[model samples]
Target: MMRRAAFALLAAALLGPLPALAQDAPLRIEITEGVVRPMPVALRFEDAGGAGELLGDITAVIADDLNGTGLFEMTEPESSPATGFDRTVDYIAWKATGTEALVTGQVALEGDSVMLRFRLFDVFAGQPLGDGMQFVSPREGWRRAAHKIADQIYARITGETPYFDSRIAFIGESGPATERVKRVGVMDYDGAGVKWLTSKDDLVLSPRFSPDGQTVLYTSFASGVPQIMSLDVETVTSTALTRDPRAMSFAPRFSPDGKWIAFSRESSGNTDIWIMEVANPSFAKPITLGPAIDTAPSWSPDGRHIVFESDRSGSSQLYVMRADGSEPTRISFGDGGGSYGEPAWSPRGDRIAFTRQTKAGSSIGVMRPDGSGEQLLSEGGRDSGPSWAPNGRVLIFTRLTADDEVPQLHSVDITGRNMRPVALNDAASDPAWGPLLP
Candidate 1:
């Protein structure tokens, strides 16, 4: 009976009216072109129903998900007060800890499922920022529940699209560079729950996720030549999309609506951009002709244009052209005049990410649609193959250094801050981020 009363009081406190300061100007982080300071936040969670390890794991995952973004810094748990789930927050005490935001949650077990109740508070304003919420899922889905909670908090504070609940498809690489073996795999965005989709018998690269996240398009060298193949993510079965033995097709990318596919095909030692109806792969047609090794066709967000790399000007450069092979124009003109390749269109259609190679080394960069405001986001160390996150604010790319030639996946913010290596058991590359789950 006492527990019931405490819960009621806590709920009332969460629903209380916010202060005028909060109503007018709530706590927010406007991510601009400048550097951003990490927001100090405190997290408090209690195991209300003897959840044991499950509760602890859920809490840790939530904290890591938020901290991994390099936006939130968790306060030292020892320095925080012993505020349990049943008590109201002491805003003054929390503010004294130098924490601007606070998150309180409770975990309980009910039958075969786990229930999580959480609330976000703006400590400076001494009021709750948003409504309290509850999430119920099976024990196996605890990580997903934690990600959902992180996404909610991130969206509410940063006013950006949430990417915590998405997945990434990549190539798992092993063995020496002389005899490397690669397989296709998919994992949660944070590198958990990895599942291999293909065997190492055949080499695979560039795993592209379909818009619906139900299929993955990749390049396979199973038949002694690189060809495009589509795999059903659920069944782990693959089917060849490019069957013509006369031409080699690779670098397959799905259109926004999944109705068409854009890829690169090499026939008679000449490469060009091609598009085919996804419903009928046998009717492939060339979108660009007389190409100077044109490849890596990435569709714009609206599917009206494509960005590719070509050497028509006697040097490799980025180009933007219509989807129907018309009016190709050069866009990239970096300061030092380097070669750009592997262009990936941002999901927001505002920027195009690519790899810039020069005399020093290769670096990952992004530019506007018209090739303006080019910014290098990664340091020069053979960085290449950039793939945008679902939110378009972050990108994952492959980085290889002179000392450590082994390729590894790394993520960076669009502003070139918070660069960090992705946690993986082996060398990985060609990261393709999938859409947020339902």
Candidate 2:
């Protein structure tokens, strides 16, 4: 039972108390710029399943995950001589092919279960950095096994926990805006095995997972007006966080420890930031007070401070404050008037990602905690709602087509490479990325 606390000072200062605008217009963003190229690497399938092609499928999946990061350019396995897990003795050979790193592995089929053994080596160092381990799983679960292996390899090489085996909970959309149908959907980090946690008949938004990935908090208009609610992912049972009939609450995010929920609450025409104990929702407290609009509160990794979007400066700007709701500081100073919103603090706690709207268009960008070194990563069309992958090097956000007819979930490397849509069978939006699965 982790105790989660919500920090709401920043939100209260911004948007003074106001009701949500009844605009049917879709949110828009622009990908104004990006980085130049991607990194390169070489990967050879370890002959784990002997000389059979069974191992090829396993290695291919692993390669996909690495390549998908846009941080690695995978070398064709056919061009390499390191065919077996134990036969990978030629470091110079792979180095000659311009590969900075190499991955080799083996797979064994034991009854209905399979064991995969893999190793990640630095081609430049000419040595393995970590011990090779074997993963055992049912034969039907090979795909997930491959993801786990990729995660292990990524962590060993980058010193960051991999997000490959994680899951994303987002709103799946269907029907028209006047009578929209939105359901809470959860899927693997790679966009596979999508399962709807809530029926489409409900108007759900801002689906966020608990730190442990067992529960989700979202805003649902199912009860008529928008209200904050929590759902146990395992049981599919939901409980409303607030019962204010005239008040509309949105943008609920859990504290790092998962003991409290920080969200926006609108009551009697005033919207402010508030926190409630998950163990006792009745224990609600307001962290922000004002006549402005303050929404979208994101907690710092240490739980000492919170970053949220507010219009206190006559425009939406990013702000940070102490968890107890004191000492507020504005963090954004870029082109204003277009409104900056949806500030998501990185799990790494080094930077914050946000959506910036200008007359040119809305763009996804990141800046230091003090609002320095702001860099716009994407442009053209709408690329709003940036959520950090568990590794903190990648972001998942909604990219709307030009006509605004289709909204898809796309991922981009922090360096601005491998910007592509996640493969899902349905339309999605307002994606909230979850932490890596343990």
Candidate 3:
């Protein structure tokens, strides 16, 4: 009996923490490849308290979030087998519709507070798939609550990090093309609650958010000279990094730790990459030197390497250098004779996405960190400036129908599928995706 007790204790320790439901195993789907046939799912969201006016919209947001990933085909609630949030789930009936998964939930109002509960189930297996959860918040946090729910579902199903609770800082374009007004604007990942951070009084470009999303780094021509500036997103206040009248600085991005920023500076007809500690811009130092123009520097997630585009090879190409500016190596070899630029390293440190400009057209592509597995994930007139979602499974970039047409934001899966324009105001460029919100 002593040996049995010891064996039981060892087994418990080895199993780690068992989930809320012991019968269900964690979803172990490796999403490295594209799915030709999306798994079909049924979602039944019911309004628990007089069916509040916002319930439908909340549920719609959840469905849109899941469907946008291109991994699931949603079934209309009317045809779903499940009735409501706490119902006795009819899993067999759900399976009969050829649905692999079912989501059932309810939104309720209790004493001026919003309460939501939901569960995901494997229809064919007739069992709960993931741990059920709930979210409670103030009435005004409906959208945030919805996004959190989507994030939970996404993380649970794909076993990947969630990116729905994030924002985008980019240059917003308006007015006539010949005299367009560009300012910094931010919005939710789904393009809601857009807040312009800068007035159209001056031209601002390449607005990048700090790792923590409290501050923004951008370029402004308000002084009649292009200079890098920082803006407090919360306070709406701005400050120029330096008052030097001779040097031109722009295209600034923060390192993963938010301790430093990398940008491009031009002087005497030459441009090079530079890095500065965030606390003291006066101590900035050049990272890449010499005669070739190098700009658009992005730091690897671990902060040990920097990837940027340079003209050192007589044509634009992607190159990687150590954070200390050592052993720079070219990584971009586009379809024989194409040029490459706008390289963005993935937050997961798996692949790098960039703009590949060939004689055929400008498109978006991804390659391994060593420059292998080059797959062009887009086909169109003009696509450039790729930014990875927090999960690194999707990329957002600027897409144009033609050279003269307005550019819009479009997202494509890394597998070269689900290419679609994000619903946002057009004529925008230079997207900088921030980390997930707290």
- Compared with the true structure, the alpha-carbon lDDT of candidate 1 equals 0.90
Per-prediction TM-score to the true structure, in the order listed: 0.90, 0.86, 0.89
Candidate 3 lDDT by residue in tens digits, 1-438 = 677656656666777546323423456777788657777877778887854787888988888888998877787544656366777788767767888878888898887688888898887888887888888889877787888888987887788899888899878888878999898988888888788999999999888889899999999998877899999999999999855679889889899999999999998989999999889998899999999999999899999999999999999999999998898999997667789998899999989999999887899999988899898998756888999998899899988767566878988888988988888965688888888988
Off by over 4 Å in 3: 1-35, 77-79, 110-112
Candidate 2: tens digits of C-alpha lDDT, residues 65-84: 88787666676654665445
Q: How accurate locally is residue 306 in candidate 2, as Cα lDDT from 0 to 100?
A: 93
Q: For candidate 3, list the clashing residue pairs, or say none.
A: none
| Candidate no. 3 TM-score | 0.89
- Give the C-alpha miss distance for residue 397 in model 2, angstroms: 0.9
Off by over 4 Å in 1: 1-35, 77-79
User: Which of the two, 1 or 3, has more lDDT?
Assistant: 1
**What does candidate 1's lDDT look like per residue over 1-438, in tens digits?**
577656556655776634423434546779669746788888888887968887789888888888988999888745686676668988888888889889899998878888998999998999888998899999788888899999999988999989999899999999988889999999999989999999989989899999999999999999988999999999999999998888999999999999999999999999999999999998999988894899999999999999999998888899999989898989998997899999999999999999999998999999998999999997658899999999999999998857757888899999998899888887899999999888
* CA lDDT of every candidate: 0.90, 0.82, 0.86
Score candidate 1 by TM-score against the native. Answer: 0.90
